[model samples]
Target chain A: MQKSTQAGFWKKNQRALAPWFFMAPGIIMFLVYVIYPIFQSIGISFYEWDGLGPKTYVGLQNYRDLLDDDSFYTSLKNNVIWLVLYLLAIPAGLAVALFLNQTVAGIRLYKSLFFFPFVISQVVVGLIFTWFYAPGFGILPHVINFFTGTPTAILADDKYATYGVIAAGLWPQTAYCMILYLTGLNNISPDQVEAARMDNAKGWSMLWHIIIPQLRPATFIALVVTVIGALRSFDLISVMTVGGPFGSTRVLSYFMYEQSLSEYGTAMGYGAAIAVVLFAIMLVFISLFIVRMLSQERNA
Target chain B: MRSLKALAGLALGVSLFATAAVAGEIVLNSDQSDPAPKKAMEELIADFQKANPGITVKWNNFDHEGYKSAIRNFLTADAPDVAAWYAGNRMAPFVKAGLFEDVSDVWKDNGLDDALKSASASMTIDGKKWGVPYTYYQWGIYYNKDVYKKAGVTEPKNWAEFVANCEKFKAAGVDCLTTGDKGGWPAAGIFDYINMRTNGYEFHMDLTAGKVKWTDPKVKATFAEWAKVVPYMSANATAIDWQDAAALMAQGKAANYVMGNFAVDTFKKGGMTNDNLGFMIFPEITAGIPRAEEAPTDTFHIPSGAKNKADARKFLAFVASADAQTKMNATLGQLPVNNKATAADDPFIKTGFTELSSAYALAQFFDRDAPADMAKAGMDGFQEFITHPENIDAILERLDKVAAKVYK
Candidate 1:
């Protein structure tokens, strides 16, 4: 009887509470996992910690040290390069999606095959590229030698090391963007495209005016993910170069790892400071994205 | 109603099991994920269990690289009763933080002071023994005897003869030296040995410990000497790993590899026999400087947060025994820390034992000897020096800047 009364009350309030019930789990999760760590890392950035020892409060000293650090600047520059080059995945992905959009025999298999690099783990991708770029043994050097008459080890030269790692990162990222664009293309309103076709609109003109206008939602998501992916590119660098051939391949993420988590010794505070700097940079893009999203919502 | 009762019963069972699981057992974390070392660890645990039948030992094994990062979390959180770590400065930080337990009683009770005499100094901090070392191995130049013979050059005794032999190998169309710095530590090994040879072991220790600046003239001399030999080394070495470079040596394309004795196993696996593979001390660079070798020692420690201290101590004492060490290192293809252990019949082992026994001092390699931040910067500098030898001053200056911040 008591349980039935409770159920009755719940049913009475269900209209008002159902949406909140649905959002509660997601909100709690975001708060705990995502939102909490950002503030926590910021808090830790003010202290010097070795991850094992007692944390000592050091005020803004970590930030001051980071300002003086040359490697921090190098990592920041590489991150900018990564952010710029990583966006290339979007256009390349859209192009591939367009090329494979048509119906044909084994089209499903071809699509799956095209999506293969994304399915493989980044660690494996890094290893494959490492093997590919290894001089005197790897196939890449052979190919380069065949063309240029001199075998070049892409990963060994400091000038090319970060670019080499970036290229490896692009392989999987491009595949991911391709999949997103394929989905967006599948969901496109056929009436508009058909009407454009009847009006003699086709190729680049149709793509730029009609297809792209409808794919703005997918493009926004792709840009957001790509930017985040570029910032968080630690695995490939670690697996391939270990920030070496002289720390030339270090990104901010990899630099943070080397400072705190690596086998050498821990400087958790310094690592957190690097993380905070990276977060600040990411916040700029994120805030711009949010503002644009808000304006779009208002228009809608 | 029936399902609710069953759920309650299941919860009750799980709670009982959880209590049973935590009552009395020693949790050991180790990085003996490799085949031979894994087997050796199993045998050691079995022996320990046989000796202490009352206690339960729960072994948690991780891969070498993963364990390094995982250790920091486990030490302060859910620390194992026993954990594998490296000796010297590597363990010093943990000891200073009071994260590692002082197992001085274990050392005293088992007379490990005499047994593990060689590693005792490394395991000690603040005049207390914080860990027990079980195994260590030698690092030196491993050369192809056939390549040396083909070039008509013998084992070089001093830097001059070594350089001349390198020239001979170069003249004969063979790469003179081979090393891999893709992972960074392999190149750091070269730096460690060269620095030791250039300024003697004391200066090398002081430098790694950050008592001396990287821009010191003594450090510059080591880089200068390394620069002279860079042209003789294998081209594009940074692209290959240590195993791949050893492959070049095994194929007789490269004459020598400045590596640990472990490279012998890889050489053997690559089909180089005892007859062709030769181990030699790095030739003397600074005359009258006592020769010091890099011999990284692997150790086990009791974490301060360990739940089962008694069982952990027993494990350490048993591991420190000469009998346990001999069998462990035999499977590990490494040298036992116990001086009283029976010597292996292997030629390389014999050579390493003799060489290490006569050495004036031992360094735990560059990465192990130096703090991690400095080691990372130092190794990066070393790798940079290899490709751009002219950038020594700039690299050293950067390293000094890092050292100033890190060592402080």
Candidate 2:
């Protein structure tokens, strides 16, 4: 009789709790892996540690040091450059998607080929670009040599190193945006596009006034990921230049890795401070993203 | 039925845990994931197991770069009984933090205080032994004999002669020194030898240990000497790696490379031989400073948190023995740290052995001797100095800023 009563209780409450039950695993994972680490890093930002040694509570000394660190400014500047330049990929991707949207023969093959760079691992892409930018024998230098009558070592020049790495990052990143735009284009309400076409809307105006409004969801996601991606640019810099030519290419992520996790004795507090700054910068974009998401939810 | 199955699984997990706890195994983490070193480690462990007859050895291997990052977490959290690390200032932080066990007793019990005396000073901190060094290799100038002969230049002995020889090599269509500073440390070997030669070994040690300032006039003098040689260094040095520079030497595009003894293999692979390849100590920059060589040693340590301290100490003692070191370094193509071990009759090995044995003191290479952050900052300055020697003041100032922060 007790078992029957318990089963009866479960059946009655199941519908009300079902959604939460389904979301429990994902919520738990996000909380543990993402949310917890952010708080832990923030807490560590106040402590002076060498990763292995006992941590000393320094209370904002790390942030004070960061204010004086020239490398920190350089990384901040580079991150801004990455953000502004990385957004170029979205429009470039949209252009490529529009160009290839035609149903010509072998169009599928062309689309797959266009998506090739995104399919490759970022590390492999970095290696490929490093070789391409190699000073003496690389194709990039040869072309530059032909144009200017002098070869330029792009990655070795501090002024050019970050841009070189950013170009490599942009190659795969642009391909990624292209795929997203392609999917968004496929999902566009054809009848609305046809009606716009009938009304003589085409080209840039058509893209602005008609098609893009329909692709807002895709655009929002692209902006979020691209902003996040630009800030976390570590792997390519590590692979291509290792922030070298006198630390010209270091971002906050790579700088933090160098400080806390590298073979150099760990400056855990300093690295955590850097992480906090990076997180705060990211939080601005995330907030804007959340507000936009909330407004969309209200409209729905 | 379901509850019984769950109970069975729990019972099995408990039994397995009990067995593991009862095993009394000593775990070792190694960075010798390369085939030859891995095999040598296996043989050494086998021999050790045969001798002990009781303690089981569980060895885990990680790749070199990954091992560097993984070591900190393991040392603090899940430390193995024994772990491999580099000697000299590279091991200082771990020792300072009390992460490494004091193994002076192992040195005393095994007579390693005498047997491994050459490496003992580096392994010691605060006058206590912290780790046992197993292998080290010498760094020197590896030159192309063909290029030198074609230029009609003999081995240079002093600053003036070295420059004149550079001119000769340049006239012969070969650059004087082929170094790749892309990784930043190839130029650092040049810096280490130059600083040691100019300011003496004591100043070099003091500089790296952060006792001396980067803006010291002596440090400037070292850069001044390096600046004199800048005209002869490869123009493309900032773009190529060490291997690429070695290829330049092999092809006679460049005359020499200043690197560790390990480059001998690359030289051989690049089709240069003992006949064409010759080794020379970096020429004296100052008349009176005794030549202190760069010979970074590879070592093993007992993590303070180890579960099996006895077995770990036993392994350290065994590693310090001439027999074990000889077998291991023979496979590793490196020099044994034990003074009593006999070296293989290889030309490069013989040269390194003679040079290191006769040295007044051994300073590990720049990256190994200095703390990691300082080394990174210093090497970057060195690379920039090579490109823009006129900006020496700025570079040294930048280095001072980093050294002040890091060495503190």
Candidate 3:
């Protein structure tokens, strides 16, 4: 009777144990590299350090100082601008996906070609845009001159530098969103589409009511990625401007780097504080996303 | 339960034993981007290893931008045994924090007293030496003699003559000066020279250290004078790199490039010779203001927590020796920091050495003298003044805020 009870327990628990064994490696790596570092960085934010020697506890002073820093305000404003403008890529990508969703000869090849920019490195994209925006000899300047009889170097002009960089960032981001939507479009139910058509629910009405709801998972992922991408906009800025022309194009990431690491960046504590604030801003979005996802899961 | 506990204890003992038995390795970090300098370092490492067979040396090289960010992170964590670093106020904070090993004994043993006294002065904090000098290149005006001749101009001797030469070059359809302010410090160098010439070396040092305010009339006048020469600058100068700007002068498109002696190679690569290029000290601005020369030096420092501190000190001493400095500079086209080191065959190096020796006092490059925060503010002010030459007062005011926050 004891042997039979043991056999029954093994049969019941094997599947649960097997899944945990499969998940162990990934969970362990995530805990070590990501989760621990977040806590460690937050701990470091309260101390004044130059990345060496004893760290003095500065408490809330670093945060207080940030409030009065003009550069902080500029960076925050630019981040907001980056986020708002970066979202435009979502609808723009959807439009492109829908245009190419129909079956056509060599459509797979065409889709890949459209998706190429997202595959290249952001550093390379920055270089390409820098050349494109350079004055006199660049294609952009010539195009502007042909149309307006005057050419303005986009990057050198402080008013336009951040916008120019954002536009370059969108090139890849839009392609990424397009690929997501195309995959979503591939999985849409044709039977539902036909039934909606029979009921005279067509075009915009059908899309809004049927197509978009079905693509909700893909849309959610696209928004999440776009938001994160906009917030972490550092590579392109570093390559194109290095936060120059009077730091007009400075973002929070570059500003943090400037404070922590650059030739003049010795305030490791101040840099950590800035990073904490950035992380806090990101946390708000993450929490909202988690709540929304949980509700959706519950409803489903 | 007894078997499980025994197994866990065994595993813990093995891990602790492994940690204790970890072997030591010497790691040297450097930020020199040029292939030649890296190659020279590799050769030096091979030689050092041969001399000490039991010791192992590992070289880690980083590109310019990557190095700037990574060094700080590395220093905070497991820093390398030895690393190349900038001097001046750039190293002052690090020295003050005691992140670097005090190498005063090594300095004395190597007898680098007179040769490196100036550089040592920059590296020292509270009378403790932190690093050994490696290579320091002089900053001056590198003009294309062909461009000057084409424009019917001669190299300037003083402030008035420099302005006259600029007028002539502009009239001849040549841009009088070309610079890349993409990083912003190149323009700051010009600002430093102007301040040094106008107010003298002591005042310039005082202003950068925040002992004086940015809105001082002398500082204001320096900006005013710099603005007067803006029209003679190359169009689209802000977008170019220093190398590309040198290329412009090499091609006779621009009349002058105010840069370091390291630019000699860039010109040679462009097929320009010593005859085509000429070097001069920054044109004097006033009759009696003792000229403050801008000389950026590169040195090596041993981290306080380095595992191979003795090896690092040995390497530093070797690099500072006249023989090593001569060989490295001759190959890399940089001026040796050791004054006693034999001069190279290169004309640019010889001229730079002569100019440095004759200067009343040498100031480390402006950005290096000022704290990082202040340097950023000062560079931004210079960029703003360059773009809107009319808003001098506003620029100074913004810089004053930056100075106040940083200096206090």
Q: Fnat of each prediction?
A: 0.87, 0.68, 0.64
Using lDDT as the yardstick, the better of models 1 and 2 is 1
**Prediction 3: B-chain TM-score:** 0.92
Model 1's C-alpha root-mean-square deviation from the true structure amounts to 4.8
The DockQ values of the predictions, listed in order, are 0.66, 0.60, 0.52
Clashing pairs in 1: A264-B372
Indicate which candidate wins on lDDT. 1
Supply every candidate's count of residue pairs whose N, Cα or C atoms clash at under 3 angstroms: 1, 1, 1
Per-residue CA lDDT of model 1 for B139-186, tens digit only, reads 999999999899999999898888888888999999888887777788
Steric clash count of candidate 2: 1
| Each model's iRMS | 1.3, 1.6, 2.1
- Model 1's TM-score against the true structure: 0.93
The reply for model 2, stretches above 4 Å from the true place, is A1-18, A200-205, B1-24
Docking quality class, candidate 3: medium
Q: In terms of TM-score, how similar is model 3 to the real structure?
A: 0.89
Candidate 3 structure lDDT: 0.84
